[model samples]
Target chain A: MKARVTVTLKPGVLDPQGAAIAQALGGLGFTGVQGVRQGKLIEIDLAEGDAATARAEVEAMCEKLLANTVIETYAVEIA
Target chain B: MKARVTVTLKPGVLDPQGAAIAQALGGLGFTGVQGVRQGKLIEIDLAEGDAATARAEVEAMCEKLLANTVIETYAVEIA
Candidate 1:
């Protein structure tokens, strides 16, 4: 099984990297952009297991290591 | 409307951030974790528009600024 974990900065968090990109975009004439924030995506290829258990484990991983809860939130997708 | 762009490091790209996290996990005794790679996710809240055009614009954003195509690939989800 494979899971994709997407971690993103919360709406109020400051994203310096994204700010830089937004500035760069305006400089490049992609002016429609209003705001941008950046975060993370982690893909995990897991061994076969019960779906509920797998989700728990992955969520633990995200909370423990993949994302900093103070500034980011994560969502997972399975396939 | 909103769209999410998930950008991840290609398999061969060196991910210092992920390596650092993996090492930290190992230090904390997450023994089964053999490897890790980190990437970026951007959530874009766009004005209501045509889905096809929104996707194209987002792809352009990813290729132009949201991701470094040299080392990453992106997937988009809309809602």
Candidate 2:
């Protein structure tokens, strides 16, 4: 099975990289961009075939290594 | 309006960061991990209300700044 994990900053967390991108977009003459927030998209190929098992394994990966947890949040999807 | 841009390395491209993550997962004792790939997820706040227009604008942004088009592909979602 394949799993996708999206890790993003929690609300109110400051994101300098995102700010830089937004500023760069403005400089590139693309108007109407008010803000930007950047995150991580991780795709994992798992040996497990069952969807439930894959989801549980991926979530454990998130808690253990995939996410910072203090400032970032993660969502996992298994297919 | 909100726009989400997911940028990923094209298939066949080597991702050292992803490899490192996979290795780390193994070190952490999680088994059955076959492989891993990492990408970027960017969320943008737009002043434009129309989804079509917002998507167009975000795509343009992707072309101009967000994605390296040579080895990276990006998808834009407007909400």
Candidate 3:
């Protein structure tokens, strides 16, 4: 099974990297861009085949390592 | 309107960050882990409402600034 974890900043949190990207886009003359927020996309290849088990395991991974719970939130998808 | 751009390293590209994550997971006693690949997920808030135009513009942004086409690939999703 394959799992994907998307870790994103929580609402109301400041994202400097995302801000920089927005600014850079403006500099590059790409208008109409009001805001930009950046996050992480982690694709994991697992030996486990059961969908439910994989989702649970990946979620555990997120809570333990993949996401900083105070400032970031994570969502896991299994395929 | 909102758009999302997912940028990932090409298949043949080496990802040290991903390797480190996999190793750390192993160290943490999480077994059955095969591999991990890390990528970027960018969310952009646009003033434009038209889906087609937004997609086109986001793709242009990806080509010109968001992705380093030489080693990475990017997909834009408008919502």
Candidate 4:
């Protein structure tokens, strides 16, 4: 099985990295770039298993290491 | 309408940011943490509209600014 985890900053959080990227892009001549926010995507290959079990393990991974709960939120998908 | 765009590093991409985070977590006394990959989630609240159009717009957004297409891929869901 393969799973993907995405983690992002919550709304209202200031994303300095994102802002900087937007500026860089604009300077690179990519215009009309209004706002930019940067986040992360994680893809994991797991032992073949059921969706329920995969969900459980992925949740543990997120809580344990994949995410910084203080500033981000995460969602998981298994395929 | 609300749409979520999830972007992740393709496998084999070296994630220095994630590695640094793992190290910091270990220093903070978190044990048994093996690997970490970071990604991003983008949530957009759009004008009430059609799902198909929302998808198109979000796709353009990802291409234009939200992601560094050089190393990342993105998926969008409209809800």
TM-score versus the correct structure, for each prediction = 0.82, 0.98, 0.99, 0.59
For B1-79, candidate 3 gives per-residue lDDT tens digits of 9998999999989999999999999998779799999999999999998999999999999999999999999998888
Off-target runs (Cα >4 Å) in candidate 3 are none
- Full ranking by DockQ: 2, 3, 1, 4
Tens-digit lDDT string for candidate 1 (A13-78): 889987887788778876666776777777665564567766776788888888899988899886
For candidate 2, the TM-score of chain A alone versus the native chain A is: 0.98
Number of the candidate with higher DockQ, 1 or 2:
2
Which candidate would rank higher by lDDT, 1 or 4?
1
lDDT per model, in order? 0.76, 0.95, 0.95, 0.73
Off by over 4 Å in 2: none
TM-score for chain B considered on its own, for each of the candidates: 0.91, 0.97, 0.97, 0.87
Looking at model 3, give its docking quality level. Answer: high
Per-candidate interface DockQ score: 0.48, 0.94, 0.94, 0.26
Candidate 4: which docking quality band? Answer: acceptable
Model 4: per-residue lDDT, tens digit, B1-79?
A: 7777887787789988868766765666544446666677665666647889778877877898777899988889888
Q: Candidate 2 residues B20-47, lDDT tens each?
A: 9999999999788999999999999999
lDDT of 4 at B30: 46
Candidate 3, residue A51: the lDDT equals: 98
